[model samples]
Target: MKLKLIRQTGIHVILAAGGALMLLPVIWMIATSFKEPESIYAFPPEWLPHPFTWSNYVETLTRPGMAFLDFFRNSMTVTVLAMIGNIASSTVVAFAFARLRWRGRDALFVVLLTTMMLPQHVTMIPVFVLFKYLGWIDTYKPLVVPAFFGAPLYIFILRQFMLTLPRSLDEAARLDGAGNFTLLTRIMLPLSKPALATVAVFAFRAHWNDFMGPLIYLNSSEKFTLAIGLHMFHGQYGTEWGPMMAAATLTVLPMVILFLIAQRYFIQGMAMSGLKE
Candidate 1:
């Protein structure tokens, strides 16, 4: 028991040290965001602002013409739409893959998984040209529309989770007059709430932090998401690290809060998804 206690203490200490190292950048960002602009360049940087101020946040929030609220609204719109699309489409695809029987189903699944190995850059030009031809350039459609097709990884995650459910439930429901659609909606969906929440969290973070997609598709300044909007701090002369960090902190806070709220679901979902029959 004493040996176990010592080993546990050593493990906890190592984990705590690693956690602090991981969080060091976050600590610096928060500290820098509160410091005055002139003091930001001070050598052997101040770990805490000597005279903390909200000016950085204030400037970031009230920057001329590029309203933070609008950027936030754009991000929220894209995130919500992407979440809905990914969930609705992926759930159906995953259900079919995990439960249904048909010729070539497993083979098709292998092909679908192969697509995951295809780098996004390899298809970027084609996708851009297709969207451009559709007159989707400079529009949210480019960012928002593709999500409805479902992501390969998300579909796989949901399918794996669904596979862990007992087929006995499906048989029992079938005896009670549950058709495929009814089984999916009533039985599968209800029990897969944790997995769904896991997917939502993943989708939310992806779309929320998505910079390259919006940067490539959106041309107009007014349509910028928060990720792009934060780039406004980089002027021709210099970058405003203070305001930039402030905006970044704001941008990252939601994801942290969301994970904290749903971390249990995330862990459980991941665990269940890893199981094999």
Candidate 2:
């Protein structure tokens, strides 16, 4: 009993130390956001500012050209739209792969999986050019449209989760004259909440922090999302570390809240996805 307790205590200490190391930067950012601009650069560095200045957040939200509200609205719209697209498309594709029997299904799945092996950086330029040709530049289309087609990773994850479910449920549904769509909506979706939540969380986070796609596609400042807008806080002469950190803290809050709310599902989905035939 003593040995087991010692082992568990050691594991927890390691985890606690790792967590603190990972969070140090975030903690520093938050702390710095509360410091006066001058104090932010103090030689010794202050872990806690004596006088906390909340004005950095106020300025960050109200600054011109930053258009923080517009950026927030735009990002929320894009993230929500992308989440819906990812969930709907991923669920449908996963259904086909998990339950349906079709010709060359496994081979086609292999091809789909192969696309995941290709680094996104390799295709980024080509995709940008394609979007430019389609006149999709300066629009949300580049950000939200492709999600409807389904991301290979999301599809694979959902498929794996679906595979872990009992086949008997699908068979039972079919015997009751339930169609594919009905089975998907009535049975699979309800049972796959964890997987769906996992996909939604990922999709939300991806587009929320997407700088490259927005930078390449959105030409106008008004159309810029939060990620791109935050970049403007850094001037060519000097960066506003205080306000920038303030803005970053605000930008991260939604994602943090979302993960906290859906964390259970995220872990459950990850576990289910690892189940094999």
Candidate 3:
């Protein structure tokens, strides 16, 4: 018992150390955001600010050429629309893959899963060419429209979770005159909240922090996302470390709060998703 206790204590200590190491960069970013610009590159870096200032945040938000508010609005618009599209499309496709029977369904699912193995870079240029031909270049359509088709990984997650549910629920609901749509809306949806929340958090984070997509497609300054706005801090001559960190902190804070709020559901969904076939 004493040896077991020692082993568990050692494991906890190792994990705590690792977690602190991982958090060091984030901690430094937050600390730097509060420091005055001149003191940012001090010989001995200050772990805590001598005089904490909100000016960095102010500058970031009100920077004349940045149009930070417009960037924020564009990000929110794209993220929310894409997230909704991902959830709606993924749920329907997942339901079909999970509950509904059809010829070649299992084979098609296997093919879909294999696509997950294909790296995004392989198809990036082709997808870009297609969107360009469709005149979607320099538009949010490149970022938002693809989401409406349903992502394979999200579909897999939802389908796996749904597969864990007993089919008896479907039969019982059908007996009560529930059709496929009714089964999904009334019976499956309520029970699958955890999985849905998991997908939502995933989708939100993906679109919110999506840099490459916006950088590729959005040509106008006003159409930039927070991720792109943060990048604008780097000029040809210098980098604005203070305001950049501030913007980064603000950008990351929402995702942190979101994950904290939905962490319970996220964990539960992940745990349950692969519990069955």
Candidate 4:
């Protein structure tokens, strides 16, 4: 029993050390954000600033051409809309894939899975050209309209979760005059809190941190999202390391808060869904 206790203690120590190592960069980012620009590169790399300051946060928001508030609003709009589309569309498609049996359903699902394996770079140009032809080049439509079509990963996650549910519930609902839409709304959605929460968390994070899509589609400064707006911290001469870090911290705060609130559902959904398939 003593030997087993020693092993567990050693494992915990190793895990704690690994976790600290992983957090070092984040710790550094926060420290840098609080440090004076001159103190940032000080020798021995202090963990805590001698005189901490909120100037970085101030400058980050008030920087010329920053428009940080507008960026926040735009990001919120895009992220919320995308999350709604992702959950709603993914749920519908996943229901069809998981519950309903059709002639070519399984084969179509295999094909859908194959599409996920196709690198985004391969389709990037073609999709861009299609959107360009649609005259959506400089619009939010290019970033958002795609969400309503459904996400492959989201669909896969939801379908996996739905499959874990007993078919008896579906059958019972059907007997009670529940059609496909009714079954989904009345029974499936009510019971899919965890999986749906997972989907929302993921969708929120994707749009929140997305840079490439916004860069590619948005041409106007007024239309820039937070990800692209952060780039403004860099000038032709040098990057504003302190204010940029402060901006990054603010940008990451919402995602952290959101994940903390939804983490229980996220973990439970993933574990339960993975157990069956």
Error of 1 at 236 (Å): 5.3
Q: Give the per-residue lDDT of model 3 (tens digit) for 1-277.
A: 9999999999999999999999999999999889898679888777887788989889888878787778878889999999999999999999999999999999999988888778898888999999999999888999999999999878988998898899999999989988999999998899988789889988998899898899888887778888987777555214778988888898788788888888886676567555534
Which residue runs does candidate 4 get wrong by more than 4 Å?
A: 235-237, 268-277
Each model's TM-score? 0.92, 0.91, 0.92, 0.93
The true-versus-predicted C-alpha distance at residue 7 of model 3, in Å, is 4.3
lDDT of each residue in 1-277, candidate 1, tens digit only: 9999999999999999999999999999989989997679898778888788999889888878657778889989989998899999999999999999989999989977888677889889999999999999999998888899988777888898899999999999999989999999999999988788889888888899898899899877788888887766454214788888888888888878888998886677567546523
| Residue 198, candidate 4: alpha-carbon lDDT | 83
lDDT of 2 by residue, 174-262 (tens): 89999999999999989988778788777888889888888888879888788887776665214778888898888887878888898
- Candidate 2 off by > 4 Å: 1-9, 235-237, 268-277
Q: Which window of ten consecutive residues has the lowest lDDT sum in model 3?
A: 229-238
- In order of listing, the candidates' clash counts read 0, 0, 0, 0
Instruction: Give the winner by lDDT.
Output: 3
- lDDT (CA) for every model shown? 0.86, 0.86, 0.87, 0.85
RMSD of 1: 2.2
Stretches of candidate 1 exceeding 4 Å from the true structure: 235-237, 267-277
